[model samples]
Target chain A: MIRICIFMMILLATYSCNDVLDVPSQSDEDIVLELWNHIDRNYCFFELKGINWDSIKTASLARLNVSTSESDLFEICGDMVLALEDGHAFLRNGQTNIVYDFKEGYDVHFDPIIVEKKYLNSSFQREGIYTYGMINDSIGYVYLYGFQNRELFENIKGYFKQRNPQKLIIDVRNNGGGDSALSLEIVEYLIDEETKVGYISVKNGEERDDFTEVANVVATLSSNNYPVKTNILINRGSYSASSYLAGMVKYIDNINVIGQITGGGGGGGQSFELPNGWVVRIPHHYFLDAKMNHIELGVEPDVEIENTELDIMNQRDLMLEMAIEY
Target chain B: MIKFDLDTYRLRFSLTPIKHGVTGLMLMISASVFSQSNKTMFFKAGFVQQSTFENRLTSNYRGGVGLNLELGFEKTSEKYVSRFSLDYSKANQGKSYISYSTIYKVDLKYENLKRIHTIKGLYIGGYIDVGTMINEKNGLWGSTNNPISFTQWASLGMVAQYSVKFKNDYLWNMSLSTPIVSYIIRPSYGSVWPDKFLEPQNFNLYERGIVTAGLKSGNVALFNNFSNTIIKTSMYFPFKNSQWHYGLEYSFNRIHTNEIKPLKQFANTISISFKRL
Candidate 1:
């Protein structure tokens, strides 16, 4: 009986049934493939390009093999994307919003005219590239680039009051843009009090005095009447805020703008971040002159002063020379 | 003293020698005879080394314990033959390895030759077996706390064996048998990944549900499935007595499925047993 029991137990142990299920692991090749799949599925404009996905696969493998770390792989991906040749499709880290100019010269092109005045507590630095003759023997030739800086404008005004210059040359060349609020204030000292500056029509898709900001400047200028002769110079780079200065002066009977057609562009743009962690800057609002036209194409200069290679070789600035002659 | 009952005379005596000596002697004599019986009870234990190459850069090795139990019963009247067997093994290497398996076999056989209740001769028989496979591994991702584990679909197979019994006596018995053919369902083996993220092409098929589905569909294609099974023709040689028996078997197995490269090998197994007949 005991023997039979042992045998039965062994038989039972041997005959029992069991079942097991399992899941599998993924390989490195699969990871690379998945990355590409995600890009193809989500990237904008994927269908438009004649991209060889198979070659991309081989290239990605070769790239990954050489990557020493995760960041290296990311950089390789960036390089591959850049190879796609779409200027707008570039990749960059989503950090700092600041854009830098690595070129040798200053972003704005101009020289400074420093003058001392008694009414003003500080000295004045008037920036411009055109030269107008000296007012007093002490106050030398002067060229005004921008009127935006309040302290700088006040001191310069004090100097003008003291010296009473014969002519003022304002150069807007290389003046990309800045605040237009100070233009009217500077114009008050330069023009007759009642003179009307040209009107501005800010085509910002709204209806209100289009040039409300410039009107504010004109209002201040109309209140303060100081008579002075001024000359403004314009160029290809004279745009936006700088054009506003040139336009305000040229509207008056005495002030004159001398140069070629401005690149009429007065649109306000906004920067935004894209889904792929890239930053894009696009024009959000448009600007117009008193004539209700876009400033983006630029405010055309009243007097066309075309500079040529011979002019540069002769070390002659025809625009400034013309302004002086006018 | 003797008591007479009917036409028979009965003699009763206290023959319990040494208080238990005669029973012990009888037991000793019977044990020897039983050890040589045609019907045998078998016990075997060994280590099985299983190697699988994925055809990738790496190959896996698993070493585990294997045990077998075989019971062969043959009665003279009709050469009534039957075999019951149990086999278990488990092996692993590194982070991956095969899981434990428990196999049970029960075979009922009929012999061609017949004799009185005490004797039997040649017989041909077939058997059916049901088996199960379990796989255990660590979870792809998550706390090491939650290890991954699962079981495979139950497997079933049929096998045929041919045997011949020579002599039956107080001293010993002798026999020989061979297993002809077998048909079986094999379990698929694989690993677990954190996500579908990095799996090889068709790797997901090794997963539990897919593997089961594939088996149901008669076998998955090479790209999608992997498994293990031994199909072979074998020869068995046995020497037995009334109380004990010894046997040896040699088989040429061809592994045509469940591998990157099909393999063929000749393997042998030896068994020892004791029985009562």
Candidate 2:
């Protein structure tokens, strides 16, 4: 009887719809200040990327006044997000979604028309999330759009056991990135030891540079030994976890990094809620190679190459041709 | 789908999520442990009107209507009574159309009250309650801005009740409860989660900051960072001259927490039940 009474009573109490809480509205200036102050205290790349955060805040706060509307505030906030320059930064207010990207005014260094016709025309096959085949009978090739799929590496392990090639070319162009552990998953299949690839840290204070002690990002060896010479193909489009991959494999003695420096996004995307119920995304975690060299600007390649439009017209992919020969 | 087995006293649920399926299986197994006792089982449903405000997300209070479901068992003796119950409720409420929040809570509790008065039916004792409440706002951004507020709390509280019996055999009861201490597990202010275990390169920043953060529980004073107060009124009388009692019950609770940011919620609920005598 007591338990039934308790349940019925609780059910009875739930039907009262009372408009009791009174919350005041925030002004446009307050919203701008909220965005600016949050990023100023928490954003991790002000010093590393040489951003003038104070000046950006001043410019944004200057745009708001007595007559500034919500749309105007949205634009102002969007501009500030763009000024952060990292692809992980974003702003959303239930209506508009905004993000910062770094794919302007630079050579893409890749062309689908050239690769499909020249390399994968007859070998148009996909296993799991991977597209792989032979560039020829002697060399193996696998091109990934991102590290969003870990099965790609798992499939690579199986592919190597079956048709073990003398060389393998890994392409990560325009791979915007995903979990960094997927990068280590690929490295584990290639390396022979528990090697430290990079360092990982998170911000712990309001200071721009305040962070936790860096933990060693290590990749251990797998049991099956497929001792193929590895070449990682990169470009300005390879970013974030892919850049992290390039940074790690470059330390391996047998691997050669071939192409332009990867488009850098070395931070993990983190978010917080604003007073107006909007979400603000920013880079909060930092990554560095084992030697304490910064990876935010990108991982330098051993063989820097770019695809020329003229070369594309001549049906020559010098990078792919180079991977086939190296 | 939910299937009940009366002979073995168990419930089986085929849920794709797998996690929920495991939890349901565990709940049934627990029910089977106490199946030998002579007890009255009750299932009840009612409506809930709630108003809540969380400064971590916003400053405004949002109100919404929702349905409540509760199931439990009770055993009564001349000296004392015990109750074990679980409840799940969900509601959609917000200030703006796009500012909506999907809030759901599954609460489990066990309490025992001992009769303190010899002449009158008055009880005084304690209860322990544990609940996890998750408030998700604006599903527009998938998994990112969801579960905007989360709190897992275990409370030790005191309960008091008084009853009056009329000559005609109808009984009226009133009770009040207040938490004496609470242990809370909540996310810190800055970061929530991307992927909890798979991310080797990420850690929550506030874990190393001023306040200590972990999965462990801490002993907090009554009303320090958390408080929940409940009041209830109920009536029981003869039902159609049979060996059953008809009852009407009303319950109210106010839950408040300011550990990281202020979140205050109030619920008023009512239901009717039949008790086997």
Best by TM-score: 2
Where is model 1 chain A poorest over a 10-residue stretch in terms of lDDT?
A: A16-25
TM-score of chain A of each: 0.52, 0.87
* Candidate 2 structure quality by residue, lDDT tens digits, A74-102: 88888998899887788888878887667
**Candidate 2 residue-wise lDDT, B118-181, digit = tens:** 5468777778899877676654432221235567788887677888778757878898776667
Least accurate stretch of 10 residues (summed lDDT) in model 2 chain B? B2-11
Candidate 2 achieves a global lDDT of: 0.68
Question: What is the fraction of true interface contacts found in candidate 2?
Answer: 0.10
Top DockQ prediction, candidate number: 2
Which lDDT tens digits does candidate 1 get at residues A1-326? Answer: 43353343333223221111111223334444544543333232222345555577688778666334645554655554544333223333343222212111312222222212311124334344222335334322444443344456555555556666677666667565544444545565666653444442211211221111222123233343446556777776665556666665655677778876543334332222222223322222233343544454457677877666565555556666677677
